[model samples]
Target: MGEWVKSSCNSPVPHNAFVAGRDVDGSRIYVGRAAFQGDVLPAKVIPNNRVAYVSHNGSEHRVQYYDVLVGQEYEWVVCGDGLVPANAISPGTTSTLERLYVGRVRHNNSLTIGKVQPSRGCILIPYCHREHSFNSYEVLVKKQRPKLWKSQSY
Candidate 1:
């Protein structure tokens, strides 16, 4: 397994850290548009494929857990918690993610980070019987409730 770190000016360094099943080298960042303009984007160090679906709007990006359909954009706010985009879509839309740790909440209209359980997922990485078909594998499908954003939870 491997580890990576995310350091941001708005928040503390090493805010979101995780162990990756594959080699996780943070030597370079695959940065893309922050989905917003003039917004000080948070330094992100998510796994190769995990992220919170974000919808970009007029000079802003709404980063949320809810799926962001193409051609649409929402708000431009972030929970103080770290983010993990959906790595894969299970049969029931239960997203399989990687390096999604820590919970976030809104306190007095301010983002707050909370307790988090280290998590990782991939169809190729078997947490169960290794002989199952990649698409039909149920190991990652069997996860606890994944509430995108709890009002005051983790």
Candidate 2:
């Protein structure tokens, strides 16, 4: 019963907001459950209503607004239990390597607890760690874990 909109058109929908529908050219598109505060498409669009759910952070929402929101598969991966840089820490000036995934993120510029996956790997990390693409630093972390020392520079 919800209303749907198009992604390309200028609509009243929020910036991070998305619409489930075909482009004016008949091409299909997809958007993730979690949206940022912008007017750009988050992911590629797919044809057909095969997608049924959109999960952001930890909460899952039903893509029932076929007329307003476009349906897309949620494929975002979460990162967990890894040492991050001193600046990456949300707060505290401890020289020690602190846990980056502290179950919170800056939502609307405010502190809020994040909903994480259920798996041991990415389950403990916040949505911020999960990315459609991994950064160079993150890639290095996976490749040189054992050989690299705790404080070694990549």
Candidate 3:
């Protein structure tokens, strides 16, 4: 884990998913892509290789999860970048539509969904996972949700 520091803006630098003096202990959580493998609850989940059945635009599809890279102290975002383009599909329809996604990072043609600091407009690097298998894996973009986001304070 990295040590927290004071930003030039004077705001406490966020460390290990917690913004100094802004986040509560044990408040950060992650959620899975679907209500399976005990991910029914609204919390963070370890991305394991499981048959994740998701629904998008009233359509159902099966998505495979690979080994997810987790535990990054901080993340940076490519401004104006969003969900990576889906390649050619084997059985399902593969449309190369550029959708507006809030919490995905892109490097070249590959894109991975991970935790995002909505307040800071940044993404968590370690949590990013690559899952685009044109002939094997198909993720429902519309049904996908950001596993990490800033909690709305009441």
Candidate 4:
């Protein structure tokens, strides 16, 4: 588990991770993808309140657990039970869209990063992977890397 560091607006976010923000209802919103009637829709806000990441054996990626505050960034380590199906999203029509939620699923017996999919309900996952049914994966909002200052020797 990586140590929690107070993150500022300029803090660096790891690769393949989403930049979480609060909605009007004060819930954490993750903009990802959703499966609808055999089609994967993009830019859809995940109907959940938490975000997650998979920390590899030698990974330094830290999981953000709460709203960013000065001198106090919340974070923790998470592990999967290996019970949830990788391709857990069920196809739904427009009428069933309200019941759709985002969940993470990882490939069995692999240490790769998990993929986000539209689930019947929100499945909070610490890590996950892929399945054959899913083709393209959702790419959410990412925090920009801080620019480094270059010293010029004239």
Best by lDDT: 4
- Considering only N, C-alpha and C atoms within 3 Å, which residue pairs clash in candidate 2? 3-68, 4-67, 4-68, 5-68, 19-70, 20-69, 20-70, 29-45, 30-45
TM-scores, one per candidate = 0.17, 0.20, 0.21, 0.21
Select the stronger candidate by TM-score from 2 and 4.
4
Against the true structure, candidate 2 reaches a TM-score of 0.20
Best candidate per TM-score, number?
A: 4
Residue runs of model 4 more than 4 Å from their true location after superposition: 1-16, 43-154
TM-score of 4: 0.21
How high is the CA lDDT of each candidate model?
0.23, 0.27, 0.26, 0.29
Candidate 4 lDDT over 1-154, as tens digits, reads: 1122222223443233333344445544332333323432222132342333322222212243322211112121231232223333322223434322233323333222232333422232232231222333222212234689999999
Per-residue CA lDDT of model 1 for 1-154, tens digit only, reads 1122332223322323321112134322211112223332222222242432121121212332221111111112222212332331111111333222222232233232221213212122211112111221111111235579758766
Q: What is the alpha-carbon lDDT for the whole of candidate 3?
A: 0.26
> Which residue segments of model 3 deviate by more than 4 Å?
1-49, 65-69, 74-94, 99-154
Task: Please list the Cα RMSD from the true structure of every candidate, rounded to 1 decimal place.
Answer: 17.9, 15.6, 18.6, 17.6
Show the lowest summed lDDT stretch of 10 residues, model 3. Answer: 85-94
Which candidate, 1 or 2, has the higher TM-score?
Answer: 2
The collision pairs in model 1 are 50-85, 51-84, 51-85, 62-75
- List the candidates ranked by TM-score, beginning with the highest: 4, 3, 2, 1
Write down the TM-score for model 3.
0.21
Q: Which stretches of candidate 2 lie over 4 Å from their true place?
A: 1-46, 50-52, 56-59, 64-78, 82-154
Give the Å shift of residue 39 in candidate 2.
16
Cα-based lDDT at residue 142, candidate 4: 20
Steric collisions counted per model: 4, 9, 4, 6
